[model samples]
Target: MLILAALLASAAPVPVASHERLSVIANGEKVGSVDAVRDHDHVAIHYDVKNNGRGPTMDETIELGADGLPQRWTLDGKATFGGDVHERLVRDGGTARWTDAMGARTAPARGTALYIGQSASPWALGLYARALLKAPGATLPALPGGRLRLDPLGPATIGGVDYRAFAISGIDLSPDLILLDKDDALFAVLDTGGATVREGHEGEVPALAALATRLTAQRYAALQQRFAHRIDAPVRIRNVRVFDPVTGTRGDPVSVVFADGRITGIQPPDAVASPGEASIDGAGGTLMPGLHDMHAHVSLESALLYLAAGVTSVRDMGNDNAFLPDLVRRIAAGEVAGPRITANGFLEGRSPYSARLGIVADSEAAALDAVRWYAARGYGQVKIYNSMNPAWVPAITREAHRLGMTVTGHIPAFTNADAMIAAGYDEVTHVNQLMLGWVLDPKEDTRTPLRLTAMKRTATLDLATPRVQRTIDRMAAAHIAHDPTAVTLELLMGGRDGAANPAVADYIGHLPIGLQRRRRQAIAPIAGPADAAAYDGAMAKVKQVLKLLHDRGIRLLPGTDDQTGLSVHRELQIYAEAGIPVPEVLRLATLAPEQYMGHDQQLGSIARGKLADFILLPGDPTRDLRELHRIAMVVKDGTLYFPSDIYPAFGVTPFAAAPKLTLPKAMPKAAGAGPAHDAMDEF
Candidate 1:
């Protein structure tokens, strides 16, 4: 989440004779802009994007050091979720010093070491590209840690202009693909569904976004060919104990046989192996069904990540209508490695604060039309977002139900969970969306950051109050489900500047430096000791609500609205911490979501004739949820994937060794083949 701040002042003029400007488009809508003024080696920038009622507002000043690297850089702004941002970086003589939410540090300026801003403008990518071209080997040692590399791609012609392209990596999990003019100035930053382009070239967004998608898809396809193992013969996972979701216990050691994308047999460990059957010695590890992330926003990177984390299936909460279905088709056809996806149609009311991810409708007929569009495309549900008119929900829900689609989303602005449940929602998307109703006055708009900052009020909320219980009772009465995404709230309310978030502290050291810093920074600003304590208490209150929901028979869906892969592990762990039994927590992450999504018949359990979607772990997750972090192998649709083989692609260290796989006598070769560790350089 790079915090590109969007000022709330008058709109900046489009590119003119005096200054250069770029338009920030999301889902075909121009929601923000970046304006920059340059003079010699000095540049002043004002970057702002207001989408979803909250985006950063930042002013930046930079002085270049002749090498295209910044000699001094300063940024002052409010972050996306309202955290304060006052970051500074300077290179003086032989020393480089910088300060951010993570505090200040000094390191010797050696070679072409570049200081990556924690809250820099998107233009920084262009600067980096220009500088890397001058560095030895087209690479430079980064300031905090690791090294950044630039890979020049072939020139592309967009809107009748030839532009150079490059992919830069070493900051985040995925490389940043950008386009530059002939002069090596950044012309545009392309993404899967949106893009930021020079003011006069707004019409090229669709083409560039498509190019971004194609490039990303090609990369993942190559990875699939390299790492995904599809044996010609059936695979028998021998000497593995199955964790039976129905019985909530580990079963006797068994041999699980699968081929042609279905589980064919579960037999005694000594069962005779067929002539063409492959074998993997699970060494008495626990085999459980692959996990499910009920709330997700999928991309090529996140898709591969989900598979590595043993999440074999996901329900995309919302995404670009054009991009998601095509990605799903590619994954299903085995051209890309990803979890099975069930996409949800997103519907939002047109407003200044509307989220720019999905279809925006301004009237009842338009909202109904959106529902029909999703249903026609086989979308499983429709997610209503903030800025949606409450008056439109009942009609929208009715149409969705008439089309055999489910409804799940935020309690729209100016409304509450009680209203949505009464109107009709199969499930509520986030716990904060529900809890806010109890603490907020009807006049206070939730579309703004107030929805999150007001969590402080939850510290004093009494769950026993009738107003709170009434909403719970209605949900229970209506059989409404909840995707607490408590892990998301934990990150929002409990994060502390300069300390790793407790939600990700266990594995922060294993991630790349950029992500490590991201997880350590706060999302919501805390003004004082009282504010911090209130936020902490708000998190505790969230867990209490989770306990109440579970005890009251309100179904809880394990979902992480935050990270794509690793965060779901923490979601289940949080459930256990919230007093849900470990066995039940495991069920919530596995079987419960499947049953709720109507996928239980073919995907949820380790039964004969079911799809072969499961994982092998050295320890039983039924005993300690942390064992999930050590998954050795994941079997999805009969394809074998070793996490140890894929982790390095994202600059992550392997948590467990891959199991030894033995092919049949005639084949006489190892079945699992993975990319070499050096393959990480390509990312």
Candidate 2:
């Protein structure tokens, strides 16, 4: 049993009732602060984060009971993408209950059950660890669902103060690194840039951030091992309606045979299974190419989730420089079960609003150097970011071209899409980046939420206007590609708390509780009927933009700027709503991107000799776009993964029973096979 050290050394023993502040730093930058007061047994904390990632401005408060139990907790703030997060949890006697966007839920107050809502801070958990020091086991109960475990990694020091390090898991999408003082009070919250340390010690950011990365990576490594499924024998999928993206048609029932990580045969439904092979019954479902999420910032934690959702590949937009390459190798080596990633070096300019991912260059020469750095590492593309100087575009684009890397990115804050296209942008990143050009003033910065808020201007812009037509004509003539990421627009437009998201409407209840609730919050400011109409109309105008581009010869790449899971389906569905047709929507998510990447021959379509990468949908997506959500099994490079097997790790229920497998009895070896399936139903 152990407790944190004494109060923060800098704070010393408080002589009287006082209010103080703690600095919150992320990646070496001061992004937020926390205010707190302590009076005997009662301690109150107020936490706020301003610009760590996407300006999740939060105001959270917690009041603790004398018994070291949480008495009352409340959080009112905005989350990533601007979703309002307002929640409260109260404890009394032997019960604890919470009220959030999903309404009310209850749990026992004792034992492992604690009502730590999604809005609860990691600091709260650190305090809980101190109280449970001599209580019992390492595992503790969590409200809503799941359990949290604290593994003390022993003594460590931060900013000359001795503390104990602990990794908190099962609370977030990933584990977080934290530390407690000698008396078990929350001492630090850590990330890659630095530690959110007690006030005077904010200079210790770099050391803590490096440590956070190592600890987080170690936890994810164990997860990867528990999820990856490997196959030894040839895999045969029988009785499937094969989807051929090239022809935009779902053919009659067929039996597909794959082995040695390649598709070997496509036979009639009546074909007999070969000896020494494993077979799965597709039950006359549509077998289509595994989807591609063209815009992603993937992580080790999200790797298996992407594959589980039938997204077998992605075009990584940007990430931690040292991490992305190693992760790609881990996935490719079958050390982890994640989607194949085509890396894109993310470049941002050194500005106050600059994102802290990838390389941030301050000058044209530095930007060119960053481009070469990515190209030398075989990165597929270089994505420029919002804070970038528009003047550096030509030099950066020239260097990337010389190094054979394609150019794509935000249309820079002060510039328009036309200038970027002429400056050699092979593609644009998001629809808002392009549409804002039509509506925003030259001086309005797209680096802030204004890029999203200004979309309302589209409500009055005529899509048929010559100014708009000229832009469309140039895009068509240049064969410029647009990711659109229409789902991002939808999230900004339609996410009203306590409402169903049409994008994932069918899957709301089936997803993890926290995620299910988050889907209901609005991400942008919609103050009145007028603002709401503008939001709705802006969404409509973008679809018109999508429709016109498709009608013309402009390339449209379907991408999920958010989580690739389920959202990619929403992206394609939005495309279908714009009258692109379901067949083309499927193609956009599959063969189209494969062709753009110049790997169609080896990757996309259901044909002999290509890599065995596809998904089995219980229903036909060509007729009903929503049917894509009914994913049963996913195959990546001939390795089979049942969504039923992978989902539970992330607290999601399996969508369907995986195909029953019959492996050769003698000596079949898979590099990384998951546990045998209990949910499989044999044909």
By lDDT, who's the top model here? 1
Weakest lDDT window of 10 consecutive positions for candidate 2: 1-10
Residue 30, model 1, lDDT: 89
Query: Which digits, one per residue and each the tens of the lDDT, describe model 1 over residues 76-161?
Result: 99888878899999998668899988899999874367888888878888878877776657787788888889998778899989
Which digits, one per residue and each the tens of the lDDT, describe model 2 over residues 146-192? 66667786777766778888876565545566878876677778765
TM-score of each: 0.95, 0.89
Q: For every model in order, what is the number of clashing pairs? A: 6, 12
TM-score, candidate number 1:
0.95
RMSD of 1: 5.8
Question: Which ranges in model 1 have alpha carbons more than 4 Å from their true place?
Answer: 1-19, 668-683
Instruction: Tally clashing residue pairs in candidate 1.
Output: 6
The local distance difference test score of model 2 is 0.77
